[model samples]
Target: MIGIADYLDKQLRDYGIKEDLSILDFGCGQGNYTIPIAQIVGGNGKVYVIDKDKTKLNQLLVIAKKVKVDKTIEILESEGQFDFDLSSESVDLVMLFNVSCCIIGQDNYPEFQKLIHELHRLTKKDGKLIIGIKEGKTMLNRVETGIPLISKEFKLDKKEKGKYLDGEKLRNGIFYSLTKK
Candidate 1:
């Protein structure tokens, strides 16, 4: 968790995720990134986290409580569906770090499209999306090198390669920042 916060604080700053901005951590698994996000965003900023794994969500809450960031963190439990409860153009940043294969990869392309469309709908016009993909993900091997085909709804503004938390250990990966088109 220590390295995660330091990494996120530096990475998120590039995306304008300072205090008082709203963020939605979609597909937030076990909240390895959520706790650090909560701290970075602080009390005024809201971190809305969504994950289908109830058990992991619960564990995240316990961790948040220990960090005294539970009040700033909001959980949106999913039912293995992309139908989120957030409103359109409501969030300043969408954190898709450590996303699952179900929403990415060639085989899950349809689901990937749906996920992007939904995330696009939820992101503010000026909001930024940061998606991190580890090596070996199906999409990472795509002809475009895992770059999403999102030019229609979002514009790929920046790409970064650095160390990110994959579960707990730090791993080198690529992440992109996309702004709504």
Candidate 2:
């Protein structure tokens, strides 16, 4: 069985993530994708992980150390807001995998657009924003509304079908790559 990390590594490669690039793993949970990304970017790169849960952030750091990629990772505990303490256009890639829906709720569609704008602000010119959404009608519906806002700052590069291990079951998902205009 392909594990979540392996699955995420494949997806990152498909998105053209390479060595020496800085990355922001927004809403990074337990270092699933974050660790693989650190490996891919190698020692010359940096992976900044942000999550609301401090415990999860600690877990991520532990995994990074276990994998010997701790030096390449920088972590921050977010307060469930869009404020990121980083300079504009400083990162080469922003991974919003499985984080869109959680950050954007049904009652706050406007806030979703604002977050997209913030993501755009954080991304370097021509940098990539890779969004991964779980394959389901409800999740799709929730994210569809923000497409236009994303389109305003990014060009739709491509979309691919992928799978992620959710608990014990592998769930299908869509990965959207958008390049900053």
Candidate 3:
């Protein structure tokens, strides 16, 4: 199994995110990536972790406290949608790892467009947004459809596929690094 801390460092190195960069992990499940990022960012930087489920947040809090990493992660219990609940243009990076489908639901319907718009709203100018998901027809097709929605508000900086971290292959999943123009 890939350790969360190692995975976080590898991903950051791969993506070229440096120290002092603030990040938001949308749908961060139970501090899997959150704890590692907290350590990676050090005391100077911050990580905002948002999830729709309160139980998961509580569990993450416990893990953070037990591991002495609670101070680095800001746990936000998303009450409405997967909204960040932070000030506009505040974050440096928004990480949507395996979260797009969960937020939009797996129904393969049309409501996902709104989620795409919301992602655009939360990102800052020049801020990078990274999204990762499994290989699936629905996810692949949704990315194709959602690209147009995001393009309306931001410009794509880079698009990559088959990127792997900690023995995990991103496969059909795509990570779109977009900047608000």
Candidate 1 vs candidate 2, lDDT winner: 2
In candidate 2 the C-alpha lDDT for residue 79 amounts to 88
lDDT for model 2 comes to 0.83
Q: Taking the tens digit of each residue's C-alpha lDDT, what string does model 1 give over 75-151? A: 87589788788789888999887674546555666677778889889998878888877765454664133345667
Candidate 3: stretches off by over 4 Å: 1-7, 82-84, 106-113, 163-173
What order do candidates take by lDDT, descending? 2, 1, 3
Candidate 2 wrongly placed segments (more than 4 Å): 1-6
Worst 10 residues of 3 by lDDT: 162-171
Q: Compared with the true structure, what per-residue lDDT tens digits does model 3 show for residues 123-142?
A: 67777777776666887676
Clashing pairs in 2: none
Q: How high is each candidate's TM-score?
A: 0.89, 0.92, 0.80
Give a tens-digit lDDT track for model 2, residues 91-162: 999998888998776647778778778878988989999889999888887777677766878888787777
Q: RMSD, model 1, all Cα superposed? A: 2.4
